[model samples]
Target chain A: MASKGTVSVEVSDLRREFKGKGSPVVALDGVSLKVGQGEIFGVLGPNGAGKTTMIRILSTLLLPTGGWAKVMGFDVEHEPEKVRRVINMASGAEKAGYDFISAKKNLWFFSQLYGIPTATAEKRIMELSEMLGLTKYLDRKFYALSTGYRQRATIARAFVNEPKVVFLDEPTIGLDVMTARSIREFLKEQARRSERTIILASHNMAEVEAICDRVAIIDKGKIIAAGTPEDLMRSLGAPALVMEVSPPQSGFEMLSRVEGVKGFTASTEEERGLSTVHIVVETDAAARAAEDAVKREGLKVVASWRKQATLEEVFVALVGRGFKEREEQDVV
Target chain B: MKARALVRLWSIFGEPLWIVVSMGFPVLSSLALSLLYYSIGAASYVGFAVLGGVMVSFWGNVLWSMASQFYWDKQEGLFEIYLTSPAPISAILIGMSVGGIIGTVPSALIVTGIGWVLFHPAVNAVWGGVILTFGLTLASLYAMGMTLSSLYLAYGREAESLNEVLQEPVSMLSGLYFPSLGARSPFPLAIQAAASLIPLTIGMDALRKTLFYGNDIWQVWPDLAILGVMAVVLLFASTYALKYLENVGRRDGTIGVRIR
Candidate 1:
């Protein structure tokens, strides 16, 4: 439960397991969190981090294998209908509605599912379309709309029901920079009203940092850390260290083994023979040690500098591995 | 229900080309039976075959449009949304069935129109029996469709294959081209008993009594009773089955995972 304010969502030790080819795979392992009414909560995780799984459960689309969750004071498992009535969810990767119909028709179709009156739904659709820059494309067939517009249409559909709580899973993923920012601003504006709570699960660190009131970092089906973004970043203590090497090198696993190198990411520009290494450190001494370690590995560091702290750094500091590295690591 | 029904309506009426092509269905069904009977030197039975063709067409639409539609919706990602809404899954399905009936009626009429032109089967205008039997048959058949819809919802592509597997054999089993239950049928007792299990078979058998022989509602009350019972039981079973199978899908983590 939330420590302050009116609690809108209460989750306790929620566990979800999927049957694997040889063994069961745990998708959500003992997740618990609370979002107070009118708070914007962000869940930060890499691909396949059980963020979507949690949102799916909260929205009453999936039942938990264990534990329990309550949305708007109704148990998700026992009173799913009640939960559904109060909450709505949107996934960035989802494709919906009939492709043959216009985007407006599709929105109208979904609005009717919630039994929204036609006039009210139409007014909402118009407002959302204009807000999302989808007004011009509303008449186009869904199959004809661009991916960005289609995603915008989907977001509009999510809001047409006027849900008390909305779950957005990577809502701006794969969007253009401007569109993503606009969507962020839109969500931020919605949160500003303090009339509803928004729970968004995203892999984009900046997005979470920019819009979330509080954040939780999840990986390997577990919440590794949770707190305000500033508090979490301050927990790392040292500024992130970035090293540029003219000749890119592989085998970044060695850096993780180095003392003081909490977690480091190595991206190679092989054709350009350059690599950028972003390292999270516990102290200034660790940043210096990471620089030394890079040189000892026979990769000449052309330049080194400090960068602003981010959720990625927090994830690295907490798990001792970068998001990309941990995500690539196999989980059963 | 209205939402799904509207989508159903649009999809059915979307392409003028498909609509034009769909009109060929009843003609082909009616013509094939008439020709088959004529070829077998059993031209007198062509009336039975003509009427059989119409029922078979309705059954076919129930399979393709109503039964398999849930799988299509899941693939399109609407089923998850439906699951999350306050709207009952059964309502969506019932809506689809209602739309499917509307979409199917024109073709059914075309077949019946052909029936009058070629076979001239007796329809002594027992309007009450005819409408009641027609209505119950649709209700029971759609309820049976709702059962298949549950299977399609959870099993995905496997249950879709059942649509194809069910098409022709069901027509044969239901005796859509012949009477299966009476001594008039060539099949053995075991076959007749098996055919009786299909609601379409019962509905069509009842339809034949009323449409071909112009039997009154009193004369064919037993078949109506069976169809009514079947509708209620299947509808009840389907309602529970939809919920149970959806839960199974959720437990398996397969509900929202789309696959070919």
Candidate 2:
């Protein structure tokens, strides 16, 4: 990892509330974090997690109602113009640029918004297109490009200005798995090579785990967990117990009685009646005790394993619920 | 960049298809209306129909290309990027008005040229007064557009509803004041009085005074001065209104239409 020296983005107790029809909706309630220069910081959250709100505020697109945010030492509210000059954002599936124009023209047009000269902007556009695998599609009209190509072009436009800070809101969304992986690799490489600070907002756990230097897990408009992925999972200090069992209905009753178990959830398949029950136990003895109890309950322990904790488990550990249990948090 | 793009549009497309459409509507309406004058043997007043068509083009351009453009930008998601850029939204909008005027001028000129060719309305224009009137009208009209653009972006649909009213067309209606003014304009005295208060109406009245009546700059100076003042005032209003509306967007957390 590159030296994380200076603070590229400093957000402190940033509050943004939307006036809801019935009442006000608070999107970011005192959310605070600092992203160091050259770090790929990830804001991970389920739907309506206020990830986009933070990105928008940091990008100077939307204003914060209370608290304050700064990008590259410029206050996002008071010095938005300076912040905008240093930062750029690309959102997944954003319908930006003129459809009638080519992707190259679109990139050039946006670069002009930042006052980039024509020759320099063109050179940068070519470089970005090449990096993003969009060179061939550069001359094609934006509306004609495939979704993957269009998304690549959008991402390229974000980087055209060589902005010091880049905000990518779900940048890999709606892409094929291979494309998503390649984009992630490219972003990782770009951040390292250029020493650029990237603030990525995504819901993909594995992607965040793989690329992010540090991750913040936001739920219900608040950050529940923030640290290195390994550190976060390790901090759980619990091994997850995965079991596949037939006739598992009665076995859950016995397993719940096992000590040292922090939390457990089960998924029963209808056709096979095989249940995949995930148990978070405080110790290895708890896993063994739970397995033996399932066997004593006349349930077939088809398969079982004690695995290292994941961010999902860490989320469950902290929130006392999995990501899927929450309702969609509407954004402003 | 937008200016160059428009110049490119002019190059490839030959004045844009809208020029034909915008020019066509006015030319046709003016020709049909002028029949009212010829029928009553008041042919001398055909300049009213001719000049009215010409000025209406600028007003229409202001209404759509300037005022309601933000709504379209928001709907298309372009406004999001615009909002994030280093250049403030107001600067871009004012720039757009410049480009829109560039794109709209050909149609205005074409209308004027055609009106001159067909009707031959004799004009002993006071060149100084004419230039001042035309220049102030353009400035004030576009400044008004800037103000509308800001207010509309702030209020969203409520201001968007006003976009349906096409152009400041009262100049054409006030032609009814001349018994032999060629067209049978439907404007009542109340509307004419109210319309007279607007900058466009004042500018157009000044333009007619200079163009047809051959009034000197001193004769039309008051209208020119009012237009100059209106231009400055509206320009300032546009900036303040935008700032106020943006604060509203922040408070409401909507950005007035964050992403369509």
Candidate 3:
């Protein structure tokens, strides 16, 4: 394992810009991050947030326009080959080893590129295929496989080298729920078993929270917040508690009258014979009192749930609600 | 390291023997058609078969190999995997170059065998083997082809247009089909002389002299020297140019970036 204090990846005031005939547009604006060895670090952002660009730079595939990054104690600009040796990258946009060849042959070719001996490469390929559930389709052509299978093969390819650092951008994008979960579990296993440093860039909140030990939400080429999932959720303050009931509930009306209750909104569902009441609970404990009042009144409580703020909410709050559609709006 | 490079080449082209066969067939057809017209003259027939029929095809194979090999890799995503690996960029290029040779060798032998059967051509056996022109020519042409392939990544879809534009000029200047008639006017002569200095032309000329005219190796030393120099120079130049292009492509996100 790497020494606890030693950073596996370090970015210092890094910036990247795409030069055009008219004006260069900055993709990263003074972005910086330091990830320790064996940690699952995540950079969460919507489209056009420079997440992929940062991953590319750290993987030694792209050069920074300003500042610098070091991977495993090697400067990205001066010692790229060494940086490349220690890390492997998988991006959603990368569709490699797919045409006119079997997935196994592609992996075998990559194994040679990584300098793995022939025997060792075959053994590793078998092991990865089994772990990633690709044994049956190993002989099949890449284009014939589903997106999930292709992605699983890609994950196996990334870890086949057993490098100390790995970058995965949107590892689970476009995958079914079960496949996404399996991939997340596999990534977690890799981090633990190999002591590999992982940098996952994705917009999937649940997947990111499930695997990432720490996450930085990036917006407008800058990180808005960086912390564990719980800490980030807590930073959003007390959540609003909303309840749906079968009959009109008079108890919640009382709770809203209490000093801590800020306000209440109610809407009745005529088809289901249910009234949905959303109350703004000023304090964390108000959710409990509201639940008690609903029970005391003997109302048929269909669902009583706190609207717990999630990473998605955090992203929207920091990056804005129209992040998806307006990513390229202010490219200047 | 050389062994590893060799293994890489074998993996790339081993099973797909058809790719090489397809490239060779057109050249063989050209020779067969020529045979239907001109009875293979017995004099210097072996050299003529090797040089005249196959030599031009050999150069054409080099061009096709360059565009096809990396262009296939570019389409397949192998290029990105290659760039990300610990292996030096030169290793991959050289490995592919070696495979290109393997792919082209069968066609060379076929042209030679067909000529002997049809023409009963005379060849200065001792002089032909001593010159080593054929090997030098193949190496130089392979190097030149690879250098052109590297430019494919930077130009994107424009690579096809760029390649088409260079096709006529490269063939005309290389002079595989027509002899450099030796500088009547400084323009065509200068071009021909420069073309004669290329390894393929030298190799082709040396083979023509040895097989057709019954000349020995000593009689064609100049061709050997020119072929040797061009091969070494182009090999080194191609290797360096490919590495430079790979580096630039990665920075621009062009290596694996999708056009759509």
* Per-candidate local distance difference test: 0.84, 0.77, 0.71
Please state the error at residue A269 of candidate 2 in Å.
Answer: 8.8
Question: Which numbered prediction scores highest in lDDT against the true structure?
Answer: 1
Off by over 4 Å in 2: A1-3, A20-24, A238-308, A328-332, B1-24, B35-42, B158-160, B166-190, B256-260
Please tell me the interface RMSD, in Å, for model 2. Answer: 3.3
Model 3 stretches astray by more than 4 angstroms: A1-5, A240-306, A328-332, B1-17, B20-24, B36-53, B67-76, B118-124, B127-131, B181-188, B246-260
DockQ of 1: 0.61
Index of the highest-DockQ prediction: 1
Q: For each candidate, give its TM-score against the true structure.
A: 0.94, 0.84, 0.80
Tens-place lDDT digits, model 3, residues A148-237: 889888888898898899999998888998888888888898888878999999987788888998898887678878888888877867
User: Measured by TM-score, how close is model 1 to the native structure?
Assistant: 0.94
Rank by lDDT (best first): 1, 2, 3
Q: Each candidate: fraction of true contacts kept?
A: 0.61, 0.51, 0.46
Tell me how many residue pairs clash in candidate 3: 4
lDDT of 1 by residue, A1-332 (tens): 25258888888999998878999889999999999877889999888889999998898778899999998899988898898888777888788768878899999988888999999999999998998899999988888998889998988888889888899999998999988888887787776673678999999999999999899899878998898889889888788998888677765666776677788777888777889888987678887877777788788898899987788888877777666767777543
Candidate 1: tens digits of C-alpha lDDT, residues B140-256: 999999888887776656866788799888888888878877878788999888988889988888877887677999999999999999999989888999899878776776778
lDDT string for model 2 (A259-294, tens) is 876666667787887988777788889888988888
Q: How many residue pairs clash in each candidate?
A: 0, 0, 4
Locate the minimum summed-lDDT window of 10 residues in model 3 chain A: A317-326
Give the TM-score (0 to 1) of chain B in model 1: 0.93
